[model samples]
Target chain A: MSETGVIHDIGYQRYTGPRLGRGAGIGALYVHGLRAAFGLGRSAKAKIFPWLVASVALLVAVIVAAIKSQFSEFTFSYVDLDDQLSWMIIFFVAILAPTLVSRDLRSNTLPLYFSRPLRAADYVAAKFLAMVTAVWLLLGVPQFIMFLGAAFTTKTGFKGVWHEIQDLVPAWGYSLLWALLFTSIGLLIASLTGKQAFAAGGIVAVFLMTTPVVAVLAQLPSTTANHLAGLTSPITLINGVGSWALDGSIGFDIGRYGPIYAIEAFCLIVACLLLLLARYRKVSAL
Target chain B: MNIIATQALTKTYGGGVTALSDLTVQVEAGVIGLVGANGAGKSTFIKIMLGLIAPSSGSVRVFDIDPVTETDKVRARVGYMPENDCLPPDVSAAEFVTHLGRISGLPRTAARERASETLRHVGLYEERYRQIGGYSTGMKQRVKLAQALVHDPDLLLLDEPTNGLDPAGRDAMLALIHRIGAEFGISVVVCSHLLGEVERICDSLIAIQGGRLLRADRISSMTTASDVLAVEVSDGADELAVRLTEMGLAVTRDHRMLLVPMDSDDAYDRILRAVTELELHLHRLDQRRHRVAELFTAKETVDV
Candidate 1:
């Protein structure tokens, strides 16, 4: 028992390495959100809905590829695959959007997030990018499968393969458009509520409830209303834009209102993103 | 240098509800306790320090950087554990903490290594792989703490670190916090309503009430010994009290004990002489010291 005291080193090391800045914070959040969207790095129970939707999507892509390879008369194009899987895309958005933003809101982890080197714009950007990437991969991967099916079945030489690549590139861009529009709208709706169930339900309702409005407006006996009807619902609006820009790939008639559809789509994405940023400016503490 | 400084900081919410008003305080390094009752603006103050919310007026700085303008620079060096339940139930603690570490600007491998180290430091190494939903309140609190410390921050803002824990859990958390501040050489701002816990681990105390600063001083200064002695007798307490009063001492009886003012140098000797003269059993004899709780009670009596 000496008078001198001993302060042992218990091996608590300090981090003196290079700490990344706002870019890294946003990148990490994007990666985390993307993984969480597909229920990666989560529990088995948490993986059920996402995997269920994904497996069905993959199954449809496989069947479409098989049917196209078997019969040359099968008229399913790469872009048409998106149109065919639009319902699955909607379901995927409903499941994925809440997992991206609503879980953070429900768990009240925004304070922990914002307490780091992350700003509100960075958070919204990272999450928006993550959802867009997730949705794009959901459509893009399957479209690539369809491309492979068509590429393998082509009797012509490199020209046919080159033609398939052109169609596949535009279709990938179209899927990106779907990802952008659906993710913005889905995230905006999901960001409003902390309950994932309510968020998922509200997203589906907003997307579903507007289709009837488009139908009623389309049957108004006026050609202008019929041509402009797709602008009412997000699904038809995307289809309208795709048909207009992608050279009538989707048969929905936009008539002379093609530019209007494009303008509306751009404005809708920007508006939703702005609203999402505003919603995160002041997060409610639990 | 002061780790945090605020000058006339005020935050007035919409509908005329003020959360903080003119809160001017400078906090140096060490384990500082922010003690206040509910709705006493403790959380509001911490939020302003973390730059989570903008102050309506006045200016604040952390590490010489204004949090409003240089929030990222300030936040890069500070770690925050919010008061509420912020853990997602679906993810394991290790994954969640490592993700948060990356968000705090650590590299991928460094984040993972530090997450494990901090979890171990908080005594949560074995259970780090379990999902947070199955964790007890104490274990969840440690997970929150691990996330805050994963980046090896210079400052830690812990809002109620021992909140919702059993007695043993509380003592363990307090000891962990003490070790973090004393051994790891990190400045900590622990926001708690329990004054006793604050007094036990805090080097300095800042008590706020109604969004105003009540007192800010060292814990030793705040709880100095008072000029009074407490004596408990197993028997003949009343006779000792009477004898002490007859001998020109102000004695007050409280239950089976007597409180006597130590105004003279021989006060202890005089009390002992009286106890011996009365043949009373000397059960206990000690000096009374002031506690942090007295500040609130003293304020209440003045307001009344």
Candidate 2:
């Protein structure tokens, strides 16, 4: 007999419930189901997602509108629509998955897990993976459409497929990388403050508000826009990625994409370490 | 050997608030009561044992595993229930418990099965499948308990499991705890501010105050109490025990009152004579036995 049954004497044979086809426990599946139904439910989705979709959609429309107008010979094609939606998908996913990571902490659901047999690092890892998977599904489906669209529209269908494969690697890789980074950063903020909004805001503030603000300030006057300064933040790293794909290099003349990847990797490692530290400090004190 | 032992465990929050202080306790393999006033360090002690917080100046071990250095192994042996209300309303009891079990390293099927059975034990059968947000407070507490027990630990740390319940709910919860500790053989560390509640269920008790150990002893070993005694005396409290013992009388202290057994009625004069010689203050010498509550309440006042 398992120790849990003997200790609890609940008496139903352990694991006698409805089974999960996958090797993972029904517990994880149950959590995923609850998240899909309520976490990504009617009330919250409309409020958070439309804005995400709209912003990404607008950016894509502008780029498409500009290209169509600038070069008269370039035909208006369905592949462009695919690319636009794909970007929107990735953008929404990058922002949304980390949003819930902070929410769980603010809600006090974390202590429940800690009181059980799980370790602090395990808890952080589970949450991290859960959030990463959410973003992957949200973005991966839409982005794959570009591959299919190119086959239907362009004369060089194989070339379109090649481009899709090339972009696919980066898009998927970045999604996971960004998910880990965001989750780590968001979790660090969440650990610092129990409030969900504050943690979420910290992520946006670092990525959207602070980095650009500093970059723009550097561009102004006797610019502190120094290379050392520009390379200091999460947003700056994202900016470098944006620059790499768009122009085959960053405007800052930063040495290749290697430095950017290295910076992101460093941030992710630190974020994970911080998460474990916070969990231990909190658990030890609980 | 002690399964859990602490040496002067103390915790001070950042704002100069001391949650626990100098609380030294040893818990073995049975039901043990951790009785104290609210804000008395029960939660603090539990947290420190699980390595949730560092003590200001103390050490702790849960199952011989230092909570800090061997936290994972230590946690594996402990099933903990917090006092506060903390359940995700959207998730069902079974789902919440299953997730916790999986996180504890149980296989998926095992996690789900345990979730089902544990919820049933806590009296949340089919309802375990329903959303927790829709359940009542009593139901919610059951979910909290289920999650704690999902891992099948050796020792269960229950921090006021009946904190906000009504009388019936409290009784039901207490009965379940007794079964877990005595019948199922799980060592229970139950903490509560209510002395009466702990006295009724615990075989041994460790009382704490301001983070210090006030007392620790088996309920029977600690107190000097005798069986039913009936004595008619002018002033006979301490002598009553002697007179009864000589004539084989059951004398016991139930607070300020001293009881002499009716079987020792033949030595009533001796009881009276000894009482006068000792110059002891006599309240009432009754045949009726006194409950543990009166004893603890009186002792608590005297200690304070």
lDDT winner: 1
Model 1, span A147-207: residue lDDT tens: 8877888888789889999999999999999999999999999999999889999999999
Docking class for model 1 is: medium
lDDT of the candidates, in the order given: 0.89, 0.64
Distance from true location, Cα of B176 in model 1, Å: 2.2
Please compute DockQ, using alpha carbons, for every candidate against the native two-chain complex: 0.62, 0.22
Fnat of candidate 1: 0.78
> Which candidate leads the pack in DockQ?
1
Per-residue alpha-carbon lDDT of candidate 1 for residues B146-236, written as tens digits (9 for 90 to 100): 9999989899999999989999999999999999999999999999999888888999999898998888888877666555789998988
Each candidate's TM vs. the true structure?
Answer: 0.92, 0.71
lDDT of 2 by residue, B161-235 (tens): 888899999998888888778776778889988877877788888887776677788776654443355454444
Query: Model 2 Cα displacement at B71 (Å)?
Result: 1.5
Per-residue CA lDDT of model 2 for A134-229, tens digit only, reads: 544444544445334444454556786686577666665555554555556655655565554565566556556656665664565443344334
